[model samples]
Target: MCRGWCWGCGWCCWAWWGRSPPSCRRCSTTGRWIICRPVPIRRGWRRSRSSCPGARRPSWCLCITGTVGSVPPIGRPPPLRSPRSGSGIGWSPSRGGVPAEDGATLMYPVASNGPGTDEKLRDAFVERVREVARSRGGLTVEVGGPGALAADAGKVYESLGGPLLYTTVGVVAVLLILIYRSPVLWLVPLVVAGVADFLSMGVAYGLNQAFGTSVSGQSSAMMTILVFGAGTDYALLLVSRYREELRRVERPYEAMKVALRGCGPAVLASSGTVAAGLLCLLAADLNSSRGMGPLGMVGVLCALLAMLTLLPATLVLLGRRVFWPLVPAYGSEPKARRSLFSAMGSSAGRRPLTVLAGGAVLLGALALGTLDLPGSLKQEDSFVDRPESVAAMRTLAEAFPGQGTQPISVITPAGRTEATIAGIQGHEGVAAVERGRTGDGWTELSVIAKGAPQSAAETATIESLRDRLPESYIGGPSAEQLDLKDTNARDRLVVVPIVLLSVLLILVALLRSLVAPLLLVVAVVAVWAASLGIGGLVFGPVFGFEGTDPGLGLLSFVFLVALGVDYGIFLMHRMREESLAGAEPAAAALTALRTTGGVIASAGLVLAATFAVLLNMGLVQLVELGFVIAVGVLLDTFLVRTYLVTSASVALGRKVWWPGRLSREPAGPVEQPPGETPPSRERVAVG
Candidate 1:
């Protein structure tokens, strides 16, 4: 390395003078030093004038100071040069060139076996990038672009699993403790739910391996939630029924069997409805949505099996002492109490039409909030907290306002490469065109658009390019997102009808009545609408989410409908049982609400809280989905199932069960003994 100060020009020049340049000389005109090695001129090198008549300065005298003969200050370096006209150091200091004084941006096109999908590959790539950057003294690297984004997203998902599981378990445990108010009782359900979750994971993974089903972090997390949420609901119903049966039956084993017999049909119906509804997601066009269908179904079914089998066995083994301090001893009747559910049932029964009309109007009003939801989410805004890749994109947007940093890839036939390039170059939005790799029969062209990435202008440009070059395949991150949005919309149209028909059939079979099934389906649909409306009202304004995820609507609808209907099943199944047990039409409705309302409320709380755990997640999509489902569950439990459905059943009388035996045959005479107070079953106390 050589360093010299040119007094006349007031500039400091640094250069690597290899081999001593054979000879060093001084220019007579300005007394400035020069390397007179007679080296051949390299590309981008220009010859400088020599004061010695016949002597020539070396072409490698690359100056870090200002241009030749300029008198710039010693500290300030020269301006950036174009990428082409410099020796790997002067070009725009950006466009594929690194300045001697600044940094450079390098783009690596990863292959199919790249870091985006593989954790080890991603880690190795990232580590290698850092190693290279570290070897270059004073240089730093920040990996960005589509590959980096995918890698970062993978990292977020990886981090999600442990924390999500722990939080969900803790939340469910606390709620179970509060609801059961028993030290030992909550443990049985919690352990069963945990086992169900793990079993679901194993089954889901097996299905993925066996069937080549795609699994994502989002789907797996949701599957865990379903196992715990739905399984616990089943546990609550069975346990509550077992407690009541213990008072009537002499032994715990007999009581457990009796409890299963009483609540087993409703549990089966609820789980079946959920599983069938989730399976409809298979009809979806989006890979994530379609894959989620089987995964979620497996979770629900695992939970059903665990609750109905393992849970019952565990409780029977534990015996009645499991409900210690408040245990229901055999033949010991519960003290009569006028509970909160009874009060609500009384209100609904008093003015069935008024209550029904008010609930409908309220739900309809909430559904209007859908009009205010934010637009479809952008990839950059998907995370609750911005990651480095998104930050890099923001910087690129600011640094290059008129040119896109990401390329729009176009593949055309090799024979028509020139014509395709010419056609793409003619577009107004195109900033530049570079011919990329050429293979056996195709040529890839990288087109830089004038508009920023993911902006409307860039999207339109991509569309226009696709339209103009029908023979070429156009794709990139933006184009893929465009396709995703379109696919999701299409899936909604196709899958919604299938989910409705499937769930409706299950409900019809469970209720054994067309009218009751229709009422429950409509109620759940209204709940979905209202839940989304509430999301619209709160997502942007309260949570500060910039845009709604494109898949939120479809995902939320499936979950709310599937999960929401479980509560309705519990209520309606109990109501049907009452009607068959010789209760009057109005009495059956009130009795159903009163007997099952506490259990439904507790179950709803557990399910909703389990989902609310998603609010603690790092993705905006999960938060939004969690919020909508949690809110929907609460609304369905307290307002819709407790008040609206009860009132509607009361209003319709036997017609609520139209065409069923209960609707056709007259109610049998009351079977109560002369002194017994109608044998009202003791509802589980949530408080």
Candidate 2:
């Protein structure tokens, strides 16, 4: 007998009772009569009397016919039809019937010969499973199954990438057009920047593919901004100088050559410093940060190469048309002090401390915002709005309470017989435990944190879990993040010293002054700290941003040092030129400002505007970074260029270029010698 009820095709029955019952079928002794009765039906069915019409007339005698076959019983109802077979029931008394004295019940089991029961049931089960699989799309069988966190991140990233890139590029172009004024001049920097971007990305892709290196999404976006802003800056400097030279030289190629020769070293030095600063990221522990080190260095290298090679070539090809229609032709020396910029510089030089103090106080006020900075690293916080990932996260949160995010795996050795996994279930801050099998005799446990996956609290929880685990268990987010954090901490120490050393080396090479690079380093450090302090105040307090992005600090340090040195070189070069003209200390400072101030300010504005495009990105890190560097450039150009260097040069007088014996002796109130009119009406180069 089957353990449960059996349905044969469409007929349902109690299999055991139907075949071996004493109550239903019977056999007779005389003439071998037999009879079988149908199972009972619902109350509404009527019994047919046609089989035994003469019922009461010795009905027991007819049962004595000695038959042994299926037949209806005497004085009982006829059998019912089989539903699946669609056959009528007919019982023959000659075949089998029952007699009162015989008292024997005959049972015949129903058999299925075609399309057997097991085959039909198996086919039905398979069909049901197929329906379920089709409905589900087999996603549960594949990686990143439906509604997975990784899949969600992928979708959100793609959606944001398009609009964010568009917004950033559009903002950069518009801002450049506004700052440069000339449409023709605007395209040159952008074109150089575009080439640099492509080359950097290509190199990064190759490195990632070849060396198994990968930059984070945030860093990739930043590389784009860095190349654009830095590229444009280098181009602007060279072109501005080239324009100035075009007016002085007869041939355009000569002017181009002079511009490249003069600006080439400065550009190389600046790019080198920036690249070195980025290489400092290699000291970072986080894979993302470490990846950025090489990625950023590559971008700076490309920008520098473009500035040195492509830029010079393009200038040689374009000639005067590079500036177009607005070329500065032959003219008398410009009246330096009469220009609005020179007057401002002269006023600034007169009250250097006041300008310095005012700038310092303003930066100090903004630096107050740093106090409110939060340290949470929630993924939603990385994006501008609550993106689709956020919505999906909400859905997941609602569906599964306390299943916040992916857990960090804490692996313990199976060989450690003293270790027990039971303790992990009770670990503080661990919400759930998923046991995973390693190779033979090894095991791992995933300890899900109680909050957002990437939050500082979660990171802390992971650390705490690591501490709680037995020494046998290796614990952390992944081996990768742990290595990254270590790299970052170590890098922080190594990068600064290397950068400082590199900057000093470059300055020493350029100026041959031991004292000059030291002063420059101090100024760069002061400006960098002040910029970060100001950024902290704005983003941390007013905007409710986190601590300054680690990348931003690293990148800004490089920019401030390298680019700051460029300004230093320009100022010192002009001062040297003025000294050769036999000017007094104060007069030379005035002359340097009057000659280089406009170009420096314009170049700084263009660079700052370009960097500001990063603010349009969705990442808060980029926003903080964009503002910080933009402000840094402005300070370097306006305050540092106009006051600090000028005032220092004035105080030092003839001693500013000391030891190298570069500065001319102070000649008191000397008149302009022949062919050396007080740069009152001279035409300087403009790119």
The most accurate candidate by lDDT is 1
Q: Name the regions of candidate 2 deviating beyond 4 angstroms.
A: 1-183, 206-213, 330-337, 361-365, 392-406, 425-434, 448-461, 473-487, 540-552, 580-582, 654-659, 663-687
lDDT of 1 at 274: 91
Worst 10 residues of 1 by lDDT: 27-36
Model 1 gets an lDDT of 0.72
C-alpha RMSD for every candidate: 19.3, 28.6
CA shift of 144, model 2, Å: 12
* Global lDDT of each candidate: 0.72, 0.54
Candidate 2 lDDT for residue 573:
65
Give a tens-digit lDDT track for model 2, residues 320-367. 665654656754243334565578768766876676567656656655
What's the TM-score of each model vs. the native? Answer: 0.82, 0.68
**Cα displacement (Å) at residue 181, model 2:** 4.1
Local distance difference test, candidate 2: 0.54
Give model 1's TM-score versus the native structure: 0.82
